[model samples]
Target: MEREKIISDVRSKAGGCFQKGEFYCSEAVIHTLNEFLSWPFDRSIVRLAAGFPVGIGRSGCVCGAISGGVMALGMVYGRDPGNAMDSRMFPVAAELHDHIKKLYKSTCCRVITKDLVFNSPERKAHCVKITGEVAAWVADKLLNDEALKDKIQPVVV
Candidate 1:
């Protein structure tokens, strides 16, 4: 299927944020990249959400969408320097983070949902939902039409 559709499906089905196995939802993003851009799944997603859940206004640290977007960007443009001089990931990460920040201020879980309490299962479920929605939306946007690339983004993304 199309990339955006995949993300949307993930968002709808997964219900919310990262719930251990929820990485399965991330699989959609990975599969979309592989099909459309020939990108690898594992490394791409790890890099994408590197500082995510934490950053995603969940008191965790970073936004999952920013992390996921950065991962997608890396899949599209990442290059291993064979050493430690590579800086490509950081800039792309920053760009994605900026994009997400613009969409949702603070990029903190507390900021996104004021009542979130990490210790509660229900709260965790809510956080997961938010993460899924954001990740899918961001992934959909980045996967938009480019002639060379695939068309993915819909109104939600």
Candidate 2:
């Protein structure tokens, strides 16, 4: 129940999801976030992230982990129709973006995995690591930010 353990657990679950080949990078992130947030959105919401893996359908543009992290952020910070937008949305999303960029030097999957052969173990490991880190980063943000934390509904047993 410690804070660090909670964040690390989110990372492990996301990474394990990808490692088990049950979900791709983006789906793992959305799935983990949805679960951690107690199903605030339907599980089907993962479909929105399905197209993001392999850098937006394998064109290798933005990192799928980054894309999923943004979506995860949106789940909490996003606004509904006719409601005022949460001011924290853009900045928080940008923070995730910048965090990945700073660590990897690029948010492009192609760039990040450039040295590894496609579908090779190295590539899969790299993606799995990124997926876990991104999930952890999102978890840390959600757990630490008071405004964002307030948005989380209590989990129903």
TM-score of each: 0.53, 0.93
TM-score result, candidate 1? 0.53
lDDT of 2 by residue, 1-157 (tens): 6787787788888888999998999999999988888788999999999999999999999999889999998998889999998999999998898899999999999999999999999999999999999998998888887755645432211
How many residue pairs clash (N, CA or C atoms closer than 3 angstroms) in each of the candidate models, in the order given?
19, 0
Q: Scored by Cα lDDT, where does model 1 land?
A: 0.51
Each candidate's lDDT (Cα)? 0.51, 0.88
Tens digits of per-residue lDDT, candidate 1, 2-39, equal 66566676565334325655453234334334433433
Strongest candidate by lDDT: 2
Q: Give the TM-score of candidate 2.
A: 0.93
